[model samples]
Each structure stands twice: as C-alpha cells, then as structure tokens.
Target: MTKEENEKRLAYLKSIVARLPEKPGSYQFYDDEHTIIYVGKAKSLKSRVSSYFHTEVDRFKTKVLVSKIHDISYTVVNTEEDALLLENSLIKKYNPRYNVLLKDGKTYPSICITNEPFPRIFKTRTINKKWGTYYGPYSHAASMYAVLDLINKLYKPRTCRQPMTKEGVKAGKYQTCLEYHIKNCLGPCVARQSFEDYQKNIAQAREILKGNTRQILRDMRAEMEQLAEELRFEEAEEVKRKYLLIDSFVSKSEVVSHTIDNVDVFSITNDEKVAYVNYIHVSNGSINQSFTFEYKKRLNETEQELLQLGIIEMRERFNSHSKEIVVPFEPDMELENVVFTVPQRGDKKTLLDLSLMNGKQYKFDRLKQAEKLNPEQKQVRLMKELQEKLGLPKLPYQIECFDNSNISGTDAVAACVVFKSMKPSKKDYKKYNIKTVVGPDDYASMKEVVHRRYSRLLEEEQPLPDLIIADGGKGQMGVIREVIQDELNLDIPIAGLAKNDRHRTNELLYGFPPMSVQLKTDSELFHVLTQIQDEVHRFAITFHREKRSKRALESELDSIKGIGPKTRDGLLNALKSVKKISEANLDTLTDLIGAAKAQIVYDYFHPENTTGES
Candidate 1:
C-alpha cells in the first residue's frame, strides 16, 4: 500500500516482463498470491509490456490493472496472428477474473446419422467421421429432439435396437415395433424399406441444411399434385404438410442475403488484459445466429490479427461446412475458398462494420459481468457470512447439509446436499433411504444419513466438508456428532437449522447455547446457504414421498393372501396401480392373475375379508 511497496511490486513486474522476447507472444499477469489475474497476447511484446509502465496513460481501467500487477510472464511466438491465437487458448484455460468470460458451458446438440450397415440417425453431443454425418451443434437439445421426432414420423426409420438384415425379413425373425403401428417408423430392421430409398431421404435432409430448401419444396409440391391427381388424397395431404413446414423454416430465415451465399463474420474488442471475440454465421446473407468467445490473456497482436486467428481456430473446431470467412479485421490465413476482407465501402462493408460494433457491445456486456461477483466469489462470501453467523473456525465454503423426510414412519428417506465454496453442488447431492430406522424418530434417521454420506467420503479419501448442517435442533446435531466423532472419528463443524412455527428457516443451533444469528437478505452468501438448505430438504422429501407411495401400494397387495412377490409384481405390471386392480372384473383378473388366483383375490376383497380374512 505504501510507495516503497508499490515500487517493489512494479520492479518485480518489470524484471519478469523484461525477460520476454520482442516477437509476437502471449503474456500472463499474476497477483500477490501467484494466482493468474490476467492473460493477453501482443504483436510486439516490448511495446505492449512497456505500455503498462506508463503512468500518464489516463486510462482508469489500465491504472487499476497496473496497481494490481505483482508479476508478469510471456511466451514468444512466430507471428502476431499466432500470438493472437495463443492468447485466446490460454485465456480459456486460465479463466482469469478480469477477462471477458463465456460463462455458459452448455454443449450444443448435433444430429448424427450412423455410418454403420444400418445407418440410423441419432442425437449426440460429440461429432466425428467414425460415427457418421453430423448436421449441427444446435443451440438446444429440444431442437435436435424435434428433428428426431419428425424424422421418425415421416421416414419411419427403425427405433428398435435390432440389427437390420434381408435374411431377418425373409425369415420373419423380427416383429415390427410399436413405432410402426403408431406410424412413427419405417421399420427398416424388418426390411420393409429399401436402403436406396433411405439414402434418398438422407440426401434430401442434407440438401435442406445446405439452404436448398426451395428445390426440395418444389419437388414435394410436384409430388403432392401428382398424388392428388391420382386420387391419393391422404398421401398428397402428408406431402403438402412437409412442403408447408419447409416453407415456414425458410421464411423464418429472413436475414439470408442473396449476395452473401456462405460466410462467417468475426470481430474482436479488448480491454487491457481481456479480449472478446464475437462471431456471426452469415449463410446466404441471413444472420441466423451469433456467439461470443472470450480470452483472458493479453494479446501482443493487433485487433485485426487476433480476429483472423480466431476465425481460423473456430473454423477448424467448428463450421466445417462454411465456405467463406468475412471479418472487419484483416485475416492472415491463406485458407483456400476463404476470403478475408475489410470492407472499406459499400453495403457489404457496412455489414462488416456493424459486426465489429456488435463485438464492442458484447465486450461492454462482459465488462458489466466482470463488475459483478461471480458464482465462486458469491459462494465464498456466503460461506464467510455463514461462518460468522454460526460462529465457526473458518468460512464454511464446503458445507454438507442433511434432511430426512417420511410419512407416518414409513418409506423414510434422507438427503445430503454439498455446498462447495458456498454454492450448492447439485451434482454432489445424494439421497438415501433410512434402511435401519423403523419409526418416525428423526434423530436416528439423521445419524444413518450422515453416517452413510461421510462413510463413503472417508472411504474414498475425499476432502471433508468444513461444516455440516442437520435439519432438526439439538437432537439431530447430537446424533451427527456421535456418528462423526465416535464412529467416523472426524472433527467437522456441525450445525442444525430449527424451523419456526411457520415452517420457515429459523434459528441456527451448533455448539451449546444455540446461537441465533440472522443473515443479510441481500448478501450472495445467504442466498447460497438458503439454496443448499432448500435443495437438501426438497431432495429428502421427494425421495420420502416416492418411497411412501411404493410402500403404500405394496401394503395394499400384501393384505391379499396367495399373492407372493412375483404374483404381486406381475399384477402391478399388468394393472399399473392398486386402484385398477381394486376395480377389475373377474374376466380382467382371470386374464392377469390366472383362474386359480383370481377366485382367491375376488374372495379376499369380497365380503369374507371384511371380517379379517386373508
């Protein structure tokens, strides 16, 4: 904080930066804790590194960055453009706080038709030539599912797992699945459809993706007219519906421009250490969709060079179908059939310029996001507040909470929710049935649940949670402590959430004297704990309800004699529910339960059972 301290830090940074080569390269800055604070690439390492030392630059953000710099490092590269590429890659790797980050890590869905002997189409998250032709990384799984549903409805490709074969068809080895009766599949496995015809359908699908929908529609319209003329009204109607769907899709792609048949547009913007690259796919002149990729490392290359590198990398990883690449920045790649143009004038130039503006807007949006505390930070803050409120040794960033739920001492189930860095880890959430507990005693249930969760965690040698919360008051906490200390021999801080009369989250009880500490409603830390508590409670109750339902159903059947486990299972499978079985006629009962058992069931549920007969 003093001048001397500042000077020492600057000197340390200078020493590190001085060792960096003058060539194009990527650089990283570390904080006092040796944590990566920023990442970047430079066209000229010397010029870019030196700029940080200039105090008179009048940039508020840059000044803030310089003040935080404790050390610097760089990796020299062959070209400015390559430096840009490296910067993007490293930024993604480190994900420094100051960088523009693409927070959503959701994988897109792609339609993949297998390259096997059967060549069936399926939805997948990954694509490779070994599988088959992959259509897209569609933004949503539902879209891929919709396409799958439509394909099944129209093409009737086999939904069954059986292998397709001419011999199987000749021998009638396979029965047509329900999909064929429902008119959703072509029953290829039975060889009802020809391979050549199936290939034609595949070709048509490819043509649709290629923006040749007009031709397909035209062909379908002609076919439909011909069918109608031949008095095949139902078949003609189906073809008409297909044509309408295609037309609707084409109309929705209104942004398609005749001039720009196939191209990808890219743009880039930067703060001192962070950079954002925004990409738009302009196929046939329509801006169908756009995405943003962020880089945390500083770039030594100019904005233009970085944009070019991003285009190449993006195309390599995705967009194999794209023919031309368009950008406002000058690209350095010599990709065949790829045109890198910086439009100086005209409508095409205007569109490119607009894309760059859009990139800047995206950069600004990221800046706003960086200003807000991220999920990890929010978790940490929540843990700190929870620690302070609960009066603990350290922030309970890794807290595990438990809850048990049941109906009338039956179908008792427990749940454990783990919070890492104050955030609920939905993936780590676990559910358990109270295998040993026979009654409504919550304390025993809590003991069983905590024991099972921690027993496995210890056996696996996993990291222990900083805090453990039980749903009940002192009784539950005591059960947890006995199991943890005496049984598990672990010394984890534990607490209990005692609810008020309104069934709302209330006082916190930990070590004796039970502290009642309230958390700020606006704090991120409070929200995190509340989320974990809610999640654990929800999970426990859900399991309990399901178990209760199953037990109730089982009990109903257990009351009937001559109905052992297998017979009971068969009755349930056939009738699906107790209500259905209760209302069944002798004929239906005979069909499912057999003649001998049917008479017994009828007598059991009839007047004789009213007096306590089995």
Candidate 2:
C-alpha cells in the first residue's frame, strides 16, 4: 500500500521484463499474493512490458498502475496481431478484473436461414456457418422484429412447411393462414407463388441485409418509374410506399458528429481497479450509436487486452454495416479482413482526441464523486444511524432484510436482500421456498427461511450480514436470532418491521421485551430502511407469483411422456404458453416441439391417441 513497497514490486517486475524474449507475445501481471491482476499482448514482449516502468511518463494514472505491479509473465507469439487476438481471448475467458471487457453479456437477434432446398428465415440469437446466412446482431429484439416485419411486407417470402419437390411444389392440404392472406407470405405451400419468384424475393431481402440501402432505393425508384411508364400506376404507388418505409427506418439513426463519416471512436476510463470503455459509432458523417464496457483490474496487459476486445466486439456487433473504427492507441489486434486505423493527424485524429478527452473527463468526474463520499464515511454514517436507533453493537455496513410472499400459502417464497454502504447489492439477493411449512405459518416459515439462508453462507465461508431485518414484529425477530445462533453459530444483530394494525410502517421491533423504537417518517435512515424492506417484499412476492404460475403449468405437463426437462423447455419456449400448446393440433405441435415429444403431447391431450398412434 506504500510507494516503497510498490517500487520493490516494480523492481522485481523489471527484472522479469529484462529477461523476457524480444518476440511478439502476451504478458501477465500479478499482485503480491500471486493473483493474476491483468493480462495483455504486445508486438514485442520485452519492449512493451518494460515501457510500463519508464520514469519519463508523468501521468499519475500510469504511475499508479506501475506501482501495483508485483510480478510479470509472458508467452511469445508468432506475430503482434496474433498476440493481440490471444490476449482478447484470454481476457474474455478469465474476465480478469482489470481488463476492459466488451460485450455486456446480452444476446442480440440474428437472422438465420436454414440451409435447405427452400431456405426459411428465422429470428435467432446464435449464428453459425451451418445456418445459411446471418444478417445481424441487431441492437434489440424490437429492431429485429421490425426488420422481419419489413422483410415480410416488402418481399413476402414463404413461411410454410410444404417441401419443394422435383415434380412440383408440394402443396400442404390446408387453407392458407392469415400470414399468406395478409400478403406477409408468398403462400408457396399453397402453390400460389412459383419457386423462381420466391427465390428472387429472397435475393432482394438478402441485398437489404447486406446494407445496400441507397442502391436498393435507387432500384425501387427505377422500377416505380418503369411501372408508371407502363401505365401500372398502382404498382408504382406500392414501390413509393416501400421506399418511404425504408427512408423512415434510415432517418431514425442518431447523428453523432458531422465532421467524420463511417468511423468508430473508442475511449477508455479507469479507476485504479475498474475500467470503462466507451465507443462512439459514426455513420455517414453522423454519430449513430454509443456503448460502454466495464472491466476490473490495474495492469498494462489488461489495458491492452481491453483495447483489443473493444475493437473485435464492436466489429462483430456492428458487422451489418461497413465502417472504420478509430482507437487512440494502436492495438496490436488481428482482425482478419477488418480495417482499423489510428490517425496521426487529420479529421479522424481530431475525433480520436475528442474521444480520449471524453474518456479522461469521465474518469475525473467519477473520481471526484468517489472522493466526495469515501466508502468508509458512507458505510459508517448509515451504520451508525441504524445502530443508534436499533440500539445494537457496531455499525452495520452489511445489512440483510427478509420478506415472504404467497397466495394462500401456495408457491410461498422468502427473499433475503443485502445492502452494503446503504446501497442495494442485487448480486447478493437470495431466495428460498417455504417447503417444510404447509400454509400461512409465517413464524415457522421465517425460522425455516432464515436457517436455510445463513447456513449456506456459513458453509461457504462468506461474510455474514452485520444486521438482519425481518418483515414482522417479535416473532420474526426471534426466529431470525434463533437461526443465526443455533444454525449459523454467530451472534448477529436482528430487528423487525413492527407494522401497525393497518399494516403500515409503524415502529422497529427488537428482542426480549419486544422494545419498539419509533422512527420519524422524514428521517433518511427511516426512508432507506423502508425502501429496502419494500423492495425485498416486492421482489419476493413477484418471484413467488412467477413460481406458482410455472409450477401450475409444469404440473399439467408432468403426465406427458418423452418430455424431460430439455424437451419441456423446448416446448415451453417454442409454444410460449400452456394455452398455445394445449390448443395446437398434432402437426403444428410436431413442427415446433419435435416429433417424439409432439406424440406424447397429443396422447396426453387426447387419451384416445388417434392422431399420434402408429
């Protein structure tokens, strides 16, 4: 924690760097405890790793980073770019706290066409070469749905099960659905459209996916003009309408900056331990989109790894469009077939500088805010207030609140919510089901829930909550304390919300004589506790309701054979709801839920089993 200590660590790291080979490779940094703090890649391991110790760098941030270095390790690669790619791969896999990570761990929709005689387009999240063509990682589900809607409207691609045959199109012996009737589908199954015509439409949809919007519009305009010349005024009007739709879609994209067209700007901010990378995407001389990535760690290798990941992830996430990405630092990242630039001087350079400035300002603002509160002050103030009011020992920085909810004891669930420094730590929220207790035994249920909650923490060697709050009076407080002492073997402070006859926040309840402490409604401490209690109650109740609904649906389906967890999940996801599955006929169910499971469903719904029996 001191400069002298840091210098000793840096000296050791410098010795390792001096011994490293001067070839392309990756490097890793470790703390005094030998924990890998950060990972990075460089064209030359020796040079890049040694640069961190350079005394000429006057930046405090750089100095601080260097001060944290305890040890260095490296692996030589074939090339600098190869090293970059390897570093990114390592960062993603390990998620080293210091590396700037790209991808918010959210899946975006991609359009996939199954490679069949008659390819069918579907909205999906996973894309592979096995699937014909994938268009996007569209920003959201709504945008993907909109694109699908537009594609259906403009192209009317087939959405049918009838297989394309050598003799002719095999028309399924069924009436065309509303999709076909509404002109959203070409009705190829009913033989209303020729295979050649459907294929041509598919080609056009693919072109749109390729982002040739201007060319597509131009082609549409020419067709409209041609139709008008041929006296087909109605056809010309349809073309104009389609053009307008495309125009509207394009216009919704936000413009970021006017000076640069088709460029992406990258910036990063770090607070010793955590780093955030922000990307500003510009298209057609306007900023269209922006994104940020948060990473943990304080190592040079980790920083470089983040830089590499930022580029690859942005490219993959924005692969639908053609654009160049600009980064302030030259990342030795290898992106096959993708162009990246670090402009030295020009309009692009100015944009890059602006982005760097933004990153620095963001770091400064965050640091200023962090310095104002100081975690100790925030924690001490909240805890001291709680202790004084509740009359317990020490400040309770780690507080846990519990709540239970159910409908007539059905799907009864209890939730334990944790707060640190007066801020909700959602990551620590734990839920439990009232399995042993039968109906509305709130006291018994509270004891069972608290025992289950803390027992796990004790087993895991995790930190225990400083104070525990229950959503009831003396009974709840007693149950909470009994569980902590008997089950957890720890003496933790316990209290309960003493609600009035109207079931409103009235007073706080504590042990033995059941002393009640009144709280002023306007007090910050009171408001904070109330907020935490309410949130836990709401969360527990919502979870209970969902569990109840799922349980009801699962119970109904348990009778069906060939329906294990995997198949049931597929059925539930494909059919969406139980009502839909129950109503679907054999063939419709088979197509979606698979043949084996479909038969089981048919047998369950219709005991006669005429539809599914061989």
Candidate 3:
C-alpha cells in the first residue's frame, strides 16, 4: 500500500527465496494479500525461486508478480516430472494469475457411450473413464450434436439415464420410456430387442465414430442383401435406410486422401504478445477432430518455440499421440519417433492451408474476446498512444476538455466534459453560466471555467485531470494556462485544438507558448482529439441552446401583466401550451382562473379591442 511497506514485503520474499533447497520442486509466489500470484516448476529450487529477484527477470507479468510478492513457498520433489506434476496441481488448486492456463470458459463437447447393459450413447462435457467410452472432444457443440443426431437416427439407441439389469428387466422392474414411444430408441430394457441385436448396431456406431464409415456402410450393404435373400423384407428395409443415412452424413465431411490415416496436423500463427495454434486430427482419410487454442508468449518466443509448446500442450489436452504430425513448417521440437511433414503441394498442402486459416480465425476471435472482457485496456492503449504521439510526460488517463458556446453575446455558456480512460463521463460534465465575463469572449470564458473547475476540485479534494484541452488555438490555451498555472499554480499539462475557417478541428497545439503539434490525420491520437473536441462542443452547444430557449420562453411570458409565475405555469401545464392561452374563450379563461385575473391576461393580447367579456 505504501513504498516502505512494499519494500519491506519484497525483502521478506527475497529472504524466503534465499533459504530454498537445491532440490527439484514447485515454487509459489504470494502477493501482498497473501494470495498465490504464480506457481512454477523448478529443476533447482534455489535457482528458479531466486530468478524473480535477479535484475534481468524481464517478462511483464513476471515483473509485476515479483513486485507484489510478499512471501515465497516451496515443495521439494523427487524428480523433474514430479515437480511438473506438483506445480500443475498447485496451479489448478490456486489458479494463480500469472500461470499460462488456457481457459476461455468453454470446453469441447464429447459423445460418451455408457459402459452399462443398455449402454446409453449421449453428448456430454464431463467424462468418468470407468463409466463410459468417449468418442470426441468436438470443437463446437453443433458438430457434436450433429453426430449425436446421426447416431440416434441410425441406431435408435436409448437416451434415458435409467439404470438397467438383465434380472430387473425379467422381473418387469424396467418400464418403456418416451424415447421408445417416439421411436428414437428400441425398448432394449423391455427386451423388445435382444442384447446381441443392440450390440451389433453399437459396434457399427463405433466404426462410424472413428471415421470408418465406408467400411461400416459396406458391411451394412452385405447384411441387407443377406436379409433380402432370406425374404425378411422389413429387416432389409431398415438396414437399407440406415446405410443410406450414414452414406449421406459421411459425404458432408472433407476428405483429404484415403492414405491420410492416424495423423495430427498443426498450424501456428504469432503476434508480438501471443501465439495461436490450430489442430486437426485425421482418421481414415477424414478430419475427425479440430480445435484452436492460443498461448501468451512470455519472452519474445519465436514461432517455432511457440509451435513446440502448443504441440505438446494441445496433444496432451486432446489426448492425441499419433506417430505422425503434418505441420505448416517443421518445428525444432523432437518427439521420439514422431515424424513431422511440411507438404509443398497437393491435398496435404490444402489441409495445412485449412489449419492455417483456422489459426487466423482463432486470432481474430481472441481479439474480439479481449475487446469484450477488458474494455479498460482498450482505453489505456489509446491514452498511451496519445501521450507518445504528443511526447507528453504522462498518459492523459483523465482528460478535461473545455468549450465555450454563445450566440453573439446572449446565453454565453462554457462546458467542461471529462474523459476518464478515454471515455466520456457525462456525470462529471460541468456547465458554467457565464459570470465575471461579459459578451462572447472565448478566451475569458475559457479562463473563467478553468479557474472554477480546478479551484472547486482543490476545495473538494477531488483528483485533477492529467491534461486540459481548450477548444481553440494559442489564445484559449494561453488564458487556460493563466488560470491553471499562473493563478492556481497547478502544473497540469494543457493542450489546444485549432479549427479551420469552417470551424472543424484542424490541428493540435501544446506548450507554454502554444504551437501546432503535427499528428497523422488517420492516427488514433487524432481520432481521440476529434472525439473529445466534438463531444465538448456538442455538450456546450446543447447547454447554451437550453439556456437561450428558457430565457426566450420566460421573456415572452413576462410581457403580459398580471400573469404571475403560478398562473403562467398553470396555463402551460393545463392548456399544454402558452401559445394556446390567447385562443381560449372568456368562459374557458374564467374556468382556468377567476374571471377577474383572466380578463387582464386576455385583454393584454387584444388591447385594441373593446371586449364585452371585460
């Protein structure tokens, strides 16, 4: 919380790290709040734990984590593998912020075939290996559901969660379900279909799941012919329909080649901060599986290094151990007896192209996700860009821009529109009705608003803005500097925006004696300045128009005598207009108020007439 406190905590953490053993282990770094901020594996506990304190430990996240470290803890392990295991366990247990955990709050869906008597085939995210046979980690729910739909259509499998046993069915303990009634399932529990018969369909379903559909279809065709030869027309018809359904579904899948079996394909793309990897698992000539994931590059990691990391991470996550992997380019990583192919042309190249395309799409999707989750970071980036472009000493995280608006001299008003983190804070916007400044004096009006703004902020102990923007050239900037620096002795940086003859934003000006600060018209800094200028101008003009309208309305009503504020408001409210009060009949006017007062109001508008009502 304070510099001394932070220094004391850092010293404590360094002391703890100094005592670590030379053994392989896992280490934890705790923040000032005594919460674990990082979990790491170490081949040597002392060396790894002390690395954070060394002068050259320069990864952005590592540096931040080290700065917050209040304590260090370690668990010694027997081997490097054991260290890795323990580190993973601690990271999962604590979910440390600095760990490279790939979580987007979404897990690929899978189809599980329960290892029970009536083996229910269903789509699920959770899998207990002892309970079922899992077919996939499908990248999208729609794809998994599509396969599930095909399986349901082909096999008529039971989908209910009801437990079943041979004895239970024999004793009539099991009842027919809605699945059977809708024909989505054959009533296997009721013995409507024999166990062997159901297993036959399931065996074929396994082949389909493995992308061996052509072989399964051939077997189905042969069985159908045999059934037809035996004159079992209905049975043959059912097999024929299933064969056709599986054929149609298989046709939709992209097929590279019949020889492209039991292979994994990888593509990697990298920006400065992160790497995106796309994976495809090929089985029996078809793309059986696909997924895209990203990794944050810690230390300017190269594409080859990132690809190696991603390959290991993804294969372990997806549980793929294919002997051969096809990649866009060969990585330096060596896996025992695993071949990596970089295809120059043909279907393999096409497949590589597809995977690379997926990588690009994954990168784009992550940018969209980052935009949604960390809106403040977007504004921070803009502010930093603006500061660098203008060579400001600090980022203008809080900016207050002023605009003075008036029509000649009447309704002179100034508005202070605040931009916090490059976003408009309408609640912080202040409107100043001109005082101590007469007529349309932009410089004086600017000076008065700047003085009042900072003076009140100082009085209330509210934080002042990092920068001030005046909506004019050196003239307005000079006056604001007089108030903020010369008068209040505040050192806040002040800038100005000058307009061309058409009163549109032209260029930015800043300094003690303001001059043009050149910035590209298409740049983010220019866009931000334009937005601030437009917003403050709009806010000032809107306030000025409102003040002018209210004054005009009041002055118009003031011309009529005996029409006090109460009667004026009543006329506006009841008649719904001040204009309609003159058109009312004498009785109407009398009904609104007493006839005596109404006569004065009615007679004021029609002074030439000798009214009988009066």
Q: What are the models' TM-scores?
A: 0.44, 0.46, 0.62
TM-score-sorted candidate list, best first: 3, 2, 1
| Model 1 per-residue lDDT at 184 | 74
Model 1 residue 529 lDDT score: 56
Q: In angstroms, how far off is 238's CA in candidate 3?
A: 4.5
- Candidate 3: C-alpha lDDT: 0.81
Q: How much is 334 displaced in model 2, in angstroms?
A: 8.9
Best by TM-score: 3
Error of 1 at 526 (Å): 36
Predicted structure 3, TM vs. truth: 0.62
lDDT of 2 by residue, 449-553 (tens): 888877878888888888888887887887777778776689887887878889898777776667877778676678888988998988898888889889988
Better of 1 and 2 by TM-score: 2
Q: Where is model 3 poorest over a 10-residue stretch in terms of lDDT?
A: 99-108
Against the unseen true structure, what C-alpha lDDT does each candidate score?
0.72, 0.73, 0.81
Ordered list by lDDT, greatest first: 3, 2, 1
Candidate 3, 1-614: lDDT as tens digits: 78898778778877888789999888887876889887777679998788778888777766776777777788998876567657666765797777665553146677888898878888788868999888777766677787888988988888778888778878889888887898877898899988888888888888787777878888889999999999999999999999989888877887878888888899988776777888988877888788887777544556775676567766766677789999988875456678899999987888899999988887877776886799877787788777976688888889999988998877899998999989999999999998988787888888888888899999999999988888888888888888987899998998888988998788888886777887877766689888999999899999999898777767777778778888877777778655788777677888888798788878876677745764
lDDT per residue as tens, model 1, 1-614: 89999888888777776776778888888888888888776778878888888767776666777788787888888876577667778766888766545433237666777775656777777767786877666553554565566555556555566766666666878788788888777766566777677777777776664456667877999999999999999989988887877677667654545677666777787765666776766655565445566655432435655565467556654554566666765655445555576667865666676677777877766555654746454445456667777778877767788888877787778888887775567898888878898889888888887888889999899889998887777778788899999998998987777777988765667675456557554555445556677888788888877777888899889988888988888989998998888778778889987998987776666654545538
